[model samples]
Every structure is written in structure tokens, then in C-alpha cells.
Target chain A: MSHNTFPHADHDPRAVRLAARDGTLVGPTAGLAKGFVQVNLVILPEAQANGFLRFCQSNPKPCPLLAVSEPGERGCAALADDLDIARDVPAYCLYRDGRLDQTVHDVSDVWRDDLVTFALGCSFTFEHALIQDGLPVRHIDEGRNVPMYRTSVPLVPAGGFAGHLVVSMRPYRASDAIRAIQITTRFPQTHGAPVHLGDPALIGITDLHSPDYGDAVSMGDDELPVFWACGVTPQQVLMDAGIAFAITHSPGHMLITDIPDSRVALL
Target chain B: MSHNTFPHADHDPRAVRLAARDGTLVGPTAGLAKGFVQVNLVILPEAQANGFLRFCQSNPKPCPLLAVSEPGERGCAALADDLDIARDVPAYCLYRDGRLDQTVHDVSDVWRDDLVTFALGCSFTFEHALIQDGLPVRHIDEGRNVPMYRTSVPLVPAGGFAGHLVVSMRPYRASDAIRAIQITTRFPQTHGAPVHLGDPALIGITDLHSPDYGDAVSMGDDELPVFWACGVTPQQVLMDAGIAFAITHSPGHMLITDIPDSRVALL
Candidate 1:
């Protein structure tokens, strides 16, 4: 895709998704959907969808559900007027019998009649808010993915879905951390507020320099690492549960929606 | 004064202050005026009042000015209809040449023509908010003073007033601390959000067990020490500057205002 042709294109999330849907944009959707809600995509068989939905409801801190599509449907009108779940996302990961089978750009080939699609809220919605409020996002500044860590804090079990809570780490100064907490609290759908702050060891993460996923950003001498529940949690839980026939958005490749980020703010 | 008589007294700030004005109640104004704006009293000679007012404006976090009375004024009608500055408070501290001269139940005896009174918002307003939100204040639970410490963070200088910032400490679990920050942010008059949290040593305090002012409350392993800019800051600055004559409320004996706490919330 020609970057120059898409001036202020990212500001309109639907436009960005349309470009992705047309196979013209095949990059991460971080800055692409500037002011709209981007989501973590999860597709499961109809038999397991009810259990996963209950899991999200019970463990809202880690899995804030934004939208859920009807069984065998590939569109979610609430998120976007024409959001095609099979192709709107930049990339998708396929899993079979609880193991990674292949990574694909679209899932139209293997669309199952009983498959249900769930669109869970992602941290990008709150991060956009934090940046708009003048708080610096270190990962964005470094042009890297937000560091994700699997904490010892276990999620509340629901039927066949159960696993430890996964968190995204962002280093901020004490004042910035306080402001971040307040900013994020407004978006309950986006994993509102922070799960833990200050020491990483408190949540069972041993090292500050190493992250289970994404690149490690610098933690200044005066800064503390603030952790927010990540959407990667469902993926981990699904893998751990050894579920058959599941699909998730590739890391950083979110499913952009028409829902403005401001619409998701509870405040 | 009989304690049983003031049953619904604390529920209404105006009623509580009215009781003090009528000489019917003269004791610690802590528990008596709940959900009301209690204030730190600072009465200075008109010659020094403007400088002190400038001092407060510069160091708002510590000395958030709620209302200021004109020289020789006995009432701040904006705060209350029958509020008498001379006798509305439970107790007053009379200072002479930067030295503690005497403590009086009422300051009507030392009233001066050039005296100007300042009613700065107190943490009691926010404490009520915290408790209402189900966060337990350790000092209030232990029936002790909220531990206060003098920090290396210097207040902005105005005229002849400048000193290290004084902070009141409240320990809470990390989650509760986040909620406390959100709750207090609504009331900017009551010092707004916390100034610093976590390590006391980061702000130059050596020990959490021994505070520079007020009694020390126990901190649990799961708790993080949160600090808010204290109203005692002005008193400390006055003491440090060695002001010739100044009158303030005695510790624990604040000036109960007629303003309701809900009125101070920015939201």
C-alpha cells in the first residue's frame, strides 16, 4: 500500500479496515485506527462459545467483551456497519485441537457453520486516550509492541476456559502512572485501570528486562512498571484449555471497528 | 457540650458550624462534621495576609484555598450565612513572633482589626469520600491522627513564604489505592489526587513508622503508602518563615465550614 495516499486515513477506523479488507494494507493496526475501537478477535465452535462468553463475563478485568457475533455469522453490526470478521482483520491465527496449525490473512476457506466470533475490547482504545491526555506511551515512542507478561494471578474458571491472567506492561513515572490509571478507568470495555503497579515481582513476574511477549521498553530510574490486563489472555487460555478449532487475531494485528473509542468510555 | 445531642450534626456541615458558632460545641471537629468541608484556619495580619494568599495560590496542592475573608471580617458569607470566623472553630492556635503563645477554645479574645482569615480545604473532605467508597482509612480505624511527613518536594515560593511540602499518608492495598486516586480526583479543593505513592524514601522520608507530624498507622504487606498534600503545609511554612504573628487551628481542631463536601466535587 502507498502510505502517502492514505493521509489522515488512520483517523477513520472504518477506512483503515476497508483498506485491510481489500488486501491493500497488511500492517499492524496500532496507529492505523486513531480514534476508533480496535478489538481482539476470537472465533470458536458454537459448543465452546457459551463457555468462553461466561469466562469473559466472570473475568472481566482480563477479558472485557465488546461484541459477540451470532453463530456462523461473519459480521458484527455493533462494531461496524459492514465489519466482515473473516477479512476485516489484517491477519489471523488458526488453531486446531489446541495447537497452532497455521497463520492466514483470511479465514473464509475454513468458516464453520457452528463457529461464533467474539470481539473483545483491546488496550489500544485506552492508550489512544492516554496519549490524547498528554501521557507518553513508551512502547509507541520506541516503535515497539507493548510488553506482555503472564502473571501468576489466575482467572476465574468458567466451564472449559481457565488460565493465568496475562498483562501488558507499560513503564511510566509515578505521576504518569497515576494519570494513566485515571485515564484508563474511563474505558471499562478496554480492560479499565491497572491490575498491578510498582513492583513486577508482586504479580510473580521475575524480570523487568524480559517479557513473555512483545519488546521490553526501558524503565527509567524514577519510573515504575504499570500492568494492564491484555487481550492475549483469551488466546493463552484457549491454548491452555486445549480447545479444538479456534482462531485469534495475530499479535498486534487487531480487528478495526467503526465504534469510536470515546463511545466505549464508561465515564 | 453533650455528644449525644449532635446526632445528625455531622451529616450537615452548616449545622455543625452553626453549633460551633453558638458556643454549643467546642471539641475536636473530626467525626462531628462528616460529609462536610472542614478547613485549616490561617488568620494573618492584613500586612502579611496578601503574601500568605499568594503563598497559597502558588502552592495549591498543599494549601488549596476554599475561601478567604476580608480584613477584620467575621463571616465568610460565601461559605455560610452565620459563620463567625472568631468563634466558629473548635480551637485555635495563637502564634506570637513565630512562637506558640497559647491555645484557646475560641480566638475572639485575640481578634485584631487587621486580621484576615483563610479557610483552606482539608483532607477530611476526601477521607469521607474514601470511606464512602468502602476504603478503610487506617488512622480513622485506629482512632489516631493521619501520619504526616515533611518531604523534600519544595512548594512554589510566593513573597516570603516557601518551605518543603508536607504530606499526609494513607496506606491501602494497590487496588484500593487506584480507587482512592479516582475518588479524590473529583474534589480538587480537597487536595485533588495524591502527590506521590509507594516508596516513602523516594520523596526523602526515611521511615514510615515515624512521621514528622501526627501518629503513625500500621502498614500491611499488601498495602502501598499513598501521600496527599497536607493542609498543615501552610503552618509548617509559617513556622519555618518565623512570622511575627499568625493564628491557626490547633491540630485535630479544624474550622468546620458550612459547605457540603458534595459541593466541592468537580464532577
Candidate 2:
């Protein structure tokens, strides 16, 4: 389906992904897919699947597992019945021996029998929640990607996977910061509550303006920087561990799922 | 019964209040009755009761009404069955013509037939919630009364009740401050959530060390001062309005009630 054919593209995650799958939508998936769960996709060989699963379990904040596909399975029945591993996502990164081989629009040509797909929860769910709660999400308002940084905080090593934490920055006034924490605490599947807040330097982020990934958003004088464990964390760990034959969704391009946001609220 | 002889002093609200009624527990009712709702008492003549009730309705964050007794009645059945208005509170401040006339142990001798007692929900309930959530409450840790300040933020006026909003200050690290907001949001009866947070100067508090009332606890370098609506707000209004014949519970020495803390949780 084309983007114009789906007028309510932002409301339906499936429709948005379908448009992206058809090459009609190639830009970032920030505002699109409003109420549904958008996930970080990671495909690995059978040998590293168990190790990554253990890594996710150990560091739940960064790698909050939503669903894991059986080896060679293209569809995750729990997320969406019509989901195709090869063509559903807009973009994917192919890795070989821990180095980037190429970026592709479709992974159908490289689909392997021993590959396993993992769908981990992303921060978009909580960002939607924060907006609903009348809290200003700086990055979204500024029309830029949420700035992310590599932190000094280390994740618990699982099997062979090990790396420092990756966090996304969102600036909010102190009162709004508190409210943001409260709203996000309900959605544990979506990276849950914030990892740290205030003083970017304390978390090893040297400068707020110079982020490692994504565009930096404006911060007000009274605003405090709130940090959430980013889904990019897993990719960083995978790269650091020098894993062979892995795939991840390109930054800001996610696997749109059928799960409603309300379904994940702990309350 | 002495404080030591009160068998259910730690577990039961009824036992603790009964001890206070029997002139046994005259000290601060902070730790004596855990999990029970302690209230800030205010007794005014029938002529001023309507005005004060309107005042509370207009400014709920500061003067959350737990229960109000009927005119000439010495008991509030909604709050407790055997609650004696005259003698249950450990101490009472008698105001004549808006002046501090005297401090009385009991108001039985001067109790007017047209007197109406208002039991305001106290921060003690929400403070218990914060402590239970593993948040470090500075005032509680230091064994001092929460610092109170008179702010420039004006309260909505109702008849003779009009004055600046009075707030209680508690310093917490940014993360703990966020958690405190969440925990306090659950207890709406106990002043609900914080009115403001971060810089004390923003809320019109001139100096952190010099408080208008109560002892100022040390705020660490990493901590931000969070301000909640103090139950002393009504007293401040009464003093400002210069009302005739108003009585309030002495600060920190509140009326131990039979209402359980769980009864006030909104969730």
C-alpha cells in the first residue's frame, strides 16, 4: 500500500510497516505507527541465539524481549500473523564476522535456515505515553531523532555478549521529568523506567550537543536530561562481541507489531 | 497507658489514637503508629466553617479534607468511631481573633457548642508511602520536622481564607525525586502530588537553609529540593486572613487517627 492510500498511517503499525515494506515509505518511523508496539529487530544464527537470549534476560532494561522467533521462522505469530522477516521492515543491517557487510531494503536473498529473529521492545511506546500524560518530549517537538550516547554503565555479561550501556536522551523540566518517570514505569516491556537522570557527564556523555547516534534536540535552561536504556544497546554489544552473521533494523526503522500499548501497562 | 504500654501502637491506628485520647502518648506521633493516617486538626466556629470548607475545596493540594464533623458534635464517625474531637489530638493551638491565645492540652473547658472540627489529610500518609518505596526522606532520616516555607504562589480565596500557598520541602537525588512524585501521586488524600520541584527559588523560597517553619535538613550536592503542599497551609491562611477563633494542631504533633493509610491510596 502507498502512504497516501493509508491516511491513518500513524495510527496503524501494520499499515505503516506495509507501506515501508513496499518501498513507499523510506524515511524514519518516528511519528508513524501511533498506538502499536514498534520493536528493535535482531536476527542471529542458531549458535548465538541462546547466548543473546541470556543477555537480554540479564540486562532487561536495554534488551526487554518482546518475542523471539524459532530458528528459520519468518513470522512471529505473537506479534503479527502476516509479518514476514524478509520484507516487512523498511531497512536492515547485515553483519559478517562482527563487521557491517551491507545495508539492504529486503533480506529475502540472504534468509538462512539457521537464522533466529528477536523482537525487543523500544522507547517509542513510553514516548507515546509521556505525550499522553501532557509531558513535552523535546526530540519529537524539535522534529529530530532522540539523541543517544554510550554510557560508562556496564551491562551484566551473558555468555559471550558484553558491552557498556547505550542510552537515549530526552530533556524535560524537573516536574515533567518526574511525571515522565511515573508514566514510563508502567511499560516494562518498553525499556521500562529511566536508567539515570541529570548530569550527562556522570553517565560518560561528555557533551549534550555531540551525541554518538541520532540528532541532538534542544534543552531549556531549567530542563534536566533524562536517560533511558536504548534498544541500540544490543547492537552495540553484538558489534563489540564480534558475532558472525547477524542482522538488525537500521536506526529509527523498527518492526511494527500488532500489540496495543495498553496491553503492556503493568497496572 | 504509657507509650510503651500501648500494645498495638505500632500496628493498629485505633490503639494509638486511644492512647492519645487517654493522655498516654503526648509526644510526636511520627513513628508510633505505622501504616495509619495521621491528620492535621482544625476546629472553627460554625460561622467560619463554610468559608474554610470552600477554602479547602478551592485548594485541594494544600488542604485535603479527610473528614469534617457536624456542628456541636465531638466525633467524626467517617474518620473514626470513638474519635473525641476535644481530647484525641496530643496538642492544640487555640487562636482568638487570629492571635495565638494559648496552647492547650485539651479544649474541653473552652469547647464551643457551635464548634466544627475539620480533619485534613496529612503528608505523614504519603511520607509512609515514599519510605515504603525505598526512597530516602531527608527529614525522616535526620529525625527533624519537614521544612516548611511560605511561597509567593497565592491560594485561591474563599471568604476569609486567603493567603500564600505553604509548602513542605524534602531534598532528594534526581532519581529519588522522580520516584517520590510517583509514590505521592498514589495518595491524593494526603495532598496528592508535589506542586513543584527542583530550584527552591522558583517557588519563592529565598534560602534553602533558612525555612519559615520546621528544621531545614541538609540538601546534598546531587539532590534537588522537592516541595509538597503542607497541611500547615490552612493555618497560614487563617493567620493571614486574621480570622477570629481558629484552632489547629501544633506542627509535627498531629492527631493520630483510626484511618488506615491504604484507605487513602487512589490506585
Q: Give me the candidate number with maximum DockQ.
A: 1
Count of backbone clashes, every candidate in sequence = 1, 0
TM-scores, one per candidate? 0.94, 0.93
Q: Score the docking of each candidate (DockQ).
A: 0.60, 0.46
Q: What's the lDDT for residue B138 in model 1?
A: 96
lDDT of 2 by residue, A88-166 (tens): 8878999988888888878989999989998999999999999888888888888788899999998999978999999
Candidate 1 structure quality by residue, lDDT tens digits, B92-187 = 888888888888877887898899999888888899888888999999999899999999998899978998999999998877888999999998
Q: Please, what is the whole-model Cα lDDT of each candidate in the order they appear?
A: 0.86, 0.84
lDDT of 2: 0.84
Task: Name the fnat for model 2.
Answer: 0.37
Native-referenced DockQ of model 2: 0.46
Instruction: Provide the lDDT at A201 for model 1.
Output: 80
Q: Interface RMSD of every candidate?
A: 1.2, 2.2
Candidate 2, residues B54-134, lDDT tens digits: the string is: 989999999999889999898888888787888877778998777788877678888888999999999989888888888
